[model samples]
Target: MTETETAAQSSIWTDEPFDVHAEDPFDRGSFVATVVRRIQVATADDPSTVFGLVGPWGSGKTSILDRVRSGLGDGWQIADFTPWSSGDAASMSLEFVNTVADLLGEKAAGEHRAKLAGYAGFIAPLLGAIPIVGSGAQGTAEHLLDAIGSRPPWHKQFADLSQAIQTLGKRVLIVVDDVDRLGGSELLTLLRVVRLLGRFRGVHYLIAYDQDTVEDLLRSTGSVGRSAAFMEKIVQYPFETPPLPRAAVIRLLNGVLEELLAKTDSHLDHLGLQRATSLVDALAPQLRTPRALGRFREHLNAFADHVSTARLDLLDYVAITWLRLNAHGVWSQLDSWRHELRSGERATSLTETEKLTADIWEGRIAEAHPQADRTGTLDVLSFLFEGVDVRERRTFIKHPRAMNDPTYFERYLLLAIPEDDVDDELIRIVAAELDPDKFREAATALARVLDGNDDALANLAISRLTVFRENYTTPNLLLLQFLAERMHVRVDEAERVGSPRNGLRPLVAREMALAVLAGETSAPDIIEMFGETEALNAVWMAPRFAEFRDRRSDLAEGFARFWADRLRSEPGAYIKGGRLGGVAELVTFALEPEETNGLLDPAVTDYDSYIDLAEGFVYAAEWVGSSYTYELQFRKDAFRSLISASTLERYRPQVLEHSGKVEYDVEGHPSRDIPPEIVKAFTVDSLSAL
Candidate 1:
């Protein structure tokens, strides 16, 4: 496999506890060393002692115990007791007693082993009929039975085991981990074994558990006193695990995120890094332990694999994945609330209804997660989405790569872009290109993506360009020229393609070109640049630029007429498969009365050319209220600018031949071409002939 392929499969983080000093990011080793020294002093003074290592779940309790065990000298014998492995109280008592005996017997030599077995024999018959659960337990049970054939009274047996432990001259440390995992009766039984039955001279107990969990279990077991009082009686010297510093947790989190970025070949820019730091700060309260950080890392790994991380805003990706893992209930409703969230992104953009909805979601999110720190989660939500709290007005410049942007919002939530939507990476490639030819080529290629002859992607692309408009260069002017001619085709594509988030407008291309030129050059300079170009779009642009001198100046009129005359020079550009929108534009802004009449004239002999001309009178009516009463209508008002009423008399035979093919229902909905309304309107006009 290639190196790149191998790197993709490798993991950069793990949740396993650190076993060595160097791997201890929490400075736990020093604490462990102190614990070890304290145990040595406490055990030297008393033959048997119980020390409780206390913390909440995932707070590294086991790690501390492991370190303390390693810190002890060779003279110490360690026996790990896992009470959860046993099914009942009897099993737990029996297994624990045997564990101590086996530890002593295995290390003791010659007469010491015999003496250890003799001591174990005293307690063998007392623990009645509990099934042996391990090989060590079986061996210890047999050794105890063989060493002493007869059983003694309970007190005498307890005394014998205690004396034997004192005489062995070896220090024993019994480490019990995750004691809180045991059930009610089992937990009470294990505590009884430690404090009463199994307490022997020179044997020390280091019990690790979450104190809150242990106390809660003790209460459920019908303990007579307060849970803390019972725990205090059993655990003489209790040490609570220190709370993890918020700064340390964030530092560790940052290091892990940086490693993940490197592993995925993704990097954050200065702004991205700043946003990430702020998000981490906001998220620190929930990320209270190494285990929580590990969970975040796991989520990040899955996100990196599932989506194109390089194309997303790093801050948004990290924030979203973290929210999904930690605040699942709120995350579940994000897609449904996308519209409100998007409108809320800018305070000025929100309506009163949307503002009310945002307030409702804020309260709802906090109510849904009552156990969470309400203010902290709300703060994170505010940071994640600007619209979540319009009153705060946390304004920032919007970017198309942000998950909160309406255009890319679905891509973030779904982890894939829609077919008609252009990817941000593709936009970046065109934006970054410096060479004029290459940039225009890339932009042209983007323009070719259409949905059944409608320029869907081009509309979406131009809408997304607002975010990257500041990155435009002199070479980007070519894009302006390219879009100018095609803007008419892309006008209604956003609606047709069902991309409401595109937010397209009729003059978006013209406005975008003006924006691109705001700092680079003046309006007159654009005329100088494209003055000699043969491109029709350039000719269309020249008059718009000339308007800067005066809206109706002679210079602007000349430029408008020049565009119309140029169109007259090349009639096929309009007559052959061309959009009629161009001719409407010329009549509105570029043509004189005579020139409009001349340009509107087309070949009536050829069927294709005649149909193209006839289409100027055909129109598809939009829905009124809810229903479209007239599917197709032909109105003379649509042709008023292009042709005079007198001119219509010249095409009487052509209109009649096409009008004879008309078909429609009584309500005037056409099945196909040749609108019936055209024949009705034409006959009425002929009766009152000019």
Candidate 2:
């Protein structure tokens, strides 16, 4: 769909506002209209009533304020000034009076404006507001206005101004907005001044402020405690505003999405606002309440391109919706389907059977994008598998990842996983595929299924590889050593093995850990890599070090000492530089270092990231009992996560298990000789991802 449409589709997911243009169909709709409704309600009378409007920092709070102030009803004085934006204390009282005078002129139309100017009297000079209206219009009006503005104890003129406003209306409601934005002294002045002004009895100072401001003041300046000492001195009623309710928020989501969708027909067209509304309602808790609906509004509009075109196919659209609907389903965990399949008395036999079928397809997806995970697959997979008659357990290879297609996972893993609603059909496809032999065949069958052109699986195939038993067995041992050395951890003594990263990224330092799983990088690499004093010192106080410190402080400290020594020798590490852009990126992906990005000079633009990619001239010195392949046998083999033949078959009879035939059970099930422990250990869900 077009860019405008994707918004309608995504709108159901969130309720936040977006940047719809002035001309968009939803711009003037009931959704936005409601936000302004409260403003109008308070401003509609001859004498406006006091009300508070609060929202997040960037949530268009000021826009509502501006609209209300401009459109307030006739014969009402509005004294609204945001002193916080200017960041000054002295000018605040003066600016407030100017606004009050302006409002008085607007409310009176033309009657008392000149009369008001004449009355600024002794209040003018003291408050410093008179010269602002007329340079030297020296009289009681000027003097009084300035006096009131500068706050020079002008009880008489202040009461006079309030009484004059009351003559125009029953009472003057001073709308002091955004007082929360001002710093220290300005805030105190506003509260104190407004409190003193309220002494006129009928007038009210309506204000809105973040609780954080007052809370911070209480924390830093003991305002809360100090104010308690003077509690009796202040006479007033305090009605703290309550937060918006849950159901009202859902209504807010509906109003916004329904209104926004009317623009391009994507939301209503693709998922129907009803279902969209349902999805949004369900997300309140996950979206973190308060402004959930508003954020939905924003996210919806952002992906407008995806939503509008979604209207073309009803099944595809609903299928997509169903996935999001069941986002927290089986695909949420690797053992979910197995856990259910293994369950009996309460199990949905037909349900389990159907879900099992979907899993067969999932295994292919896993094989295809070995790097991918099962999250997000239920949506598209549910749609694709929904109509696929699973009674006979027929197999078909649709886009993988059970809920999300392989294409989505490739992109998703590079970022964070979006919480998706999932569909049931995904589990069915996976169940049938999990029957080892069938799963293996179906996975291999995909090469023929797509005729090798499935666009979604194309990128995924880079990690999905076929292993020949003849070429695998004992030949690939060096890969194990290589992996072991790099990870700073040991690989088992067992010679050879294989794995893939097809669709999603590896989890838990998995980029580096996958090498360990595939026998390419060792755990020791992690240990020894950190053992470098120079490398350790380079990254000691960085924020990314937080997780590394928390998770494995022992390893991190070793690297810290190693780096300290390394840096001490050089004294100027990065200043004595070599390119590290790739190392920076790779390590970032691997270690997630928060503060490791030592900046480069603005002029040095062409940075290479391959600082450690140099092919094996080992950095260890002889003192560490490490010789240059003297006693050690060095193999001239290139390392890759996936298994290969030439590199393996030469060393051992076979480097990995590449045989087409593994012994099968009578029912054609692949032998569990592969070991459930091994299968279980091979997490379809990588922990590193979380």
lDDT of 1 by residue, 578-683 (tens): 3344445544454556656645554344544544565544545554545445454444443555555555666655555555343444334533343546534443
Instruction: State, as a TM-score between 0 and 1, how close model 2 is to the true structure.
Output: 0.36
Least well predicted 10-residue stretch by lDDT in candidate 1? 500-509
Task: Name the best candidate (by lDDT).
Answer: 1
Cα RMSD for predicted model 2: 26.6
Model 2: worst 10 consecutive residues (lDDT sum): 609-618
- Candidate with top TM-score is 1
**TM-score, per-candidate, Cα-based:** 0.67, 0.36
C-alpha RMSD in Å of predicted model 1 compared with the true structure: 9.2
